[model samples]
Target: MARVQFENIYKRFGKVEVVHDVSFDIKDKEFMVLVGPSGCGKSTCLRMVAGLEEPSEGQIYIGDRMVNGVDPKDRDIAMVFQNYALYPHMTVFDNMAFGLKLRHFPKAQIQKRVEEAAATLGLENLLKRKPKELSGGQRQRVALGRAIVREAQVFLMDEPLSNLDAKLRVETRANIIKLHQSIQTTTIYVTHDQVEAMTMGDRIAVLNGGVIQQLGTPQELYDRPSNMFVAGFIGTPGMNFFPGAKVVAEGDTTKIVLDGMGQVEVPADYAKIARDAAGKELTFGIRPSHLEDAALVGEDSQRSSIDGTVDVVENLGNELQVYLTAGGKNIIATLDSRSRVVAGNKVKLYVENDRMHLFDTATGEAFF
Candidate 1:
């Protein structure tokens, strides 16, 4: 395993720049995920590391070597693409051993390596089967096995689980994590799915508009987003944003006034942050999970409650996602599965004050 570093990397196609001064370090044996929406340049960034694409400027390092001019084959990196690029005519064993064979490795060593990789990936019984004869999951495993047999210092996977069914994707995801753990190969994964990035990456780099918006652990990105875009993009159901809200001070306390919903008291620390911005427009953000049914909360709970008309109620077995419309603003609350709320019902929802996020109306930067 080796450390991978991108220093002020920029990529451009003609006059249109797709990547802008992106920089980050992937430690030895660390699983780093590059995640964003389509056209965000995540795949381009990964391609640069694999020597498939050259950066317009800046330098890239694999371990202690500068690999800017190195050929892809000589980079000592193995890449697993989105499509399982296996040879249909070759058996799994031959597919896995093709690289070693091309490099003129000994017959015994190739056999040993292929067998070891097959055993590691639980493909011992399917070594004789062709790619066309295997299931999607199996084919994907064969592709991964092909990479594993190389035993390269780094592994670059680009949406390797995108083609699998939902259940199969979950299974394959677990398998990939296990493989990384067992082998401890430095891995850089590219995915557009936030859930996959959150679950699989040791540290995630969130990109947008050809820029690195945030880089941190999943928990850090989820709990303390740097800006409105990061806050809204990293969560399931996204964050409910209420615009044009004002901060009002009552005595020594501060409160945020939601037009249709009642006032929500700010915590002391937040009150200090909001005091100078009183009467100015600000954006209010609250995650669905931080909102709960007020009726179910303890009486002594310090949460601030607001009233809204339920627009929809989705029961997700273990939890209920309640969509509400208050004062022309839409909000969603994720509550217990036992919640009895229904469409058109007027319900009281409680917000955890300390968990609320405030952003500048114009700049979209978080206030606290």
Candidate 2:
């Protein structure tokens, strides 16, 4: 395993720049995920590391060796693509051994590596099966096994699970995580799915518009996102955003006023950061999970309450997602699955003040 680093990496296509001074370090044996929406330059960044695409400017290093001018085959990296790029006619064993055979490895060594990879990937029983005969999940395992047998310094996976069914995707995700744990290979994964990024990576770099927006652990990005974009992108249901919000100091307390909705009372300690921003438009953010039905909350709970007309309710097995309009802005609340709330019902929701996020209206930067 080896650490990977990008030093002020920049990539351009003719006159249009796609990657702009992107830089980050992936420690030895660490799993790093590059995640963002489509056309966000995540795949381009990964290609650069794999030596498939050279950076227009800046340097990339695998271990301590600069690899900007190196060929992909010389980069000591193995890539697993989204399509599971397996050979149709070749058996699983041959597919995994193909790389080693091409490198002119001894027959015994190639067989040993292929068998070991098949065992590690739980494809031992399917070694004789062709790609067409195997299930999607099995085929993906073969793809992984092919990479594993290479014993490369780094493993790069680009949306390797996107083709699987939802249930199979979850299972494969766990399988990949287990595989990483046992082998502890340095991995750089690229995906548009935030859920995949959150669960798979030891550290995630959230990218957008060809730039790294934030890089942190899953919980760090979820709990303390650097800005409005990070806040809105990292969560499952996404945070509810209310623009044109005003904060007013009221003696020992502060009132966060939402036009046409109502004001939430916050203690001095929580509102101190907004003291000087009174009357200035600010963006208010609250995660759906932080909002709960007022009736479910204890009377002494410190949460402030707001009333809204429930517009929609979604019942997942363990929780209910309720969408409502409060203060003239649409918002979502996650509540107990036992909640009886339904569309058209007028309900009071309680917000956890300390858990709320405040951002600048114009720049979208977080205030606290």
Candidate 3:
């Protein structure tokens, strides 16, 4: 079926555990991303599947076979690395055909495969160019063509776009998505960039401190993260955190007590849970996009508002990223460009009541 699976996987280097009991499955033709900060053991996990590193415990399966003891060459998988790794002296066509040449494939067959991959990656016109003559994006496509010509059951790409310029990264990212749709190859991609993980992956496994924090579709991770780590790490600018928040019941309504800021009344549907969590030290999380200029919100009683002093305002043409401090906690809010809020002024930011996230302070797990 060309599905990749990891069962109770563990990796240790010199008695220091790195990957701990990690397990996940990449379905056939699925694009699964392994993402986290550097030194999170994500590359180590990919290396295990590629047979470059043996796991300290448990098993790894490619398609249905346990490949723990198999040599990398025999694993029936193709890998594209972070670096282009193209031979400076070789032409794009030659680089793409190198692996086939090593296997002694028929000359006509090698040419056919290389030509097909080159066409797929839009490198057909640049096949005769050497690595030094090509741009970073073209070299990367040559690397992709090399992997494509193999037609392996799975494609393993490790930060393949990291070396490209920002504009090229965006263009190449779209190209990779289109290529995946065309080939329908099972892909396991690794990157430290969450934006890449969010946009490119069919599903993402977020790793941190050598362990997986959460695994799900992009929307699931964004809208309902399992814990504080996932909530903070998955978004740009991360999520705003208000630590030491408390939930309290006041007569018919339940409210979240933000130390210096006034209490936020809980919605009727969430009142019961808020009451149950009352008196505990909790963390409140809200995305920058969820907070808006209170003036733009008029006087909606359904939404709550908090007052803060503007610390900074970053104008990005289409929107304003306002940094403010409320209740002694720093917060960032994405507001409309039309808002007149500026630095060093008192601002009231309206909160999207339904978008708020509550997390357990001690364990970092999300309550809702």
Candidate 4:
């Protein structure tokens, strides 16, 4: 296990710089994921640490040693590429043993390492077969096994499961989690999918436009996001935003009336936050999961419910996704699986007062 650190990291492609002053630390044996949309410089950051790409500025360290100028192999890390990169003609066993053989490990030692790695990845039964004989998931496991045989200090995976089918991707994700628990090796994974990052990482770093927007444990980032981008990016179905809303004070309670969306009473603690927004434009945020069918929720102090006409219904087996247009505002809610809500019908929807997130429209920063 090793601690990985990036110090004010920067990358450049000719005169057009990509990554800008990026910095973060991955604790020893932690499963940390860097995630964002395409061209966000996440894969580029991983490549720099792997020594496959040089840092335009700053330094990268693995454990206590600076590895800025170290060769990729000498960095004592194993990388599982997205493409799998398996040799077409080589048997799975040879592919797993290739690195050790190149390093001139004794035949018995190489066999032991490969066999153990094969078993760990459940590839033992396919060792004699070539990659062409295997399924996409099986081939991916072979790629993982190849890295496992190295027993490197750190592991770097760059969207290795992207090529697998949805079901296989989920299974492989679970397998990777179990593998990490058993091996306890430090890993830095990069992906553009937020679902993978949330499920697989102990902590996630959300990146956008070549800079990290937020970094924290999955729950921390979800519950207490630092900014609008993160709040919107980290959640499934994303967070709902009503721009140019007005905050109006009603007696002791602080309230914000959304555009075409009804007024939501704010908590007393947040009253001061909304007080400064007399005539200024404000953005109100609410997560999809927090928006519930009024019949399913209480008129309690938790939230305020308003009426909406169902626009669409997405039945996702275990749960129902109800899209509605209320107060002239469009929103989605994950309702109970047995929900009888249908399109064109009207139903009451609750927007929790305490769960309301207010942001300055211009800066996109959450109002504390």
The regions of model 4 sitting more than 4 angstroms off are 277-280, 301-303, 337-340
Tens-digit lDDT string for candidate 2 (1-368): 89999999999999999999999999999999999999999989999999889999999999999999999999999999998788898999999999999999999999899999888999999999989999999999999999999999999999999999999999999999999999999999999999999999999999999999999999999989988988999988999988988887767778777777655666556677887766567988889998888787887233377778999998888999999988777889999886788799898888787787888888888876
Pick the TM-score winner.
Answer: 3
Per-candidate local distance difference test: 0.90, 0.90, 0.91, 0.87
lDDT of 3 at 38: 96
lDDT of 1 by residue, 270-356 (tens): 898887766556988889998888878886234376778999999889999988997777888999887788899998888887888
- What are the per-model C-alpha RMSD values against the true structure? 1.5, 1.6, 1.3, 1.8
Candidate 1 TM-score, C-alpha based: 0.96
What TM-score does model 2 achieve against the real structure? 0.96
Across residues 234-313, which tens digit of lDDT does each residue of candidate 4 receive?
98998888787788887787778765556788888888868986666688888878877777666652446656799999
User: After superposing candidate 1, which stretches have Cα over 4 Å from the reference?
Assistant: 276-280, 299-303
lDDT by residue for model 3 over 41-88, one digit each (tens)? 989999999999999999999988999999999999999999768998
Candidate 1 lDDT (Cα, 0 to 1) = 0.90
What residue runs in model 3 are displaced by over 4 Å at the alpha carbon?
301-303
* TM-scores, each model vs. reference: 0.96, 0.96, 0.97, 0.95
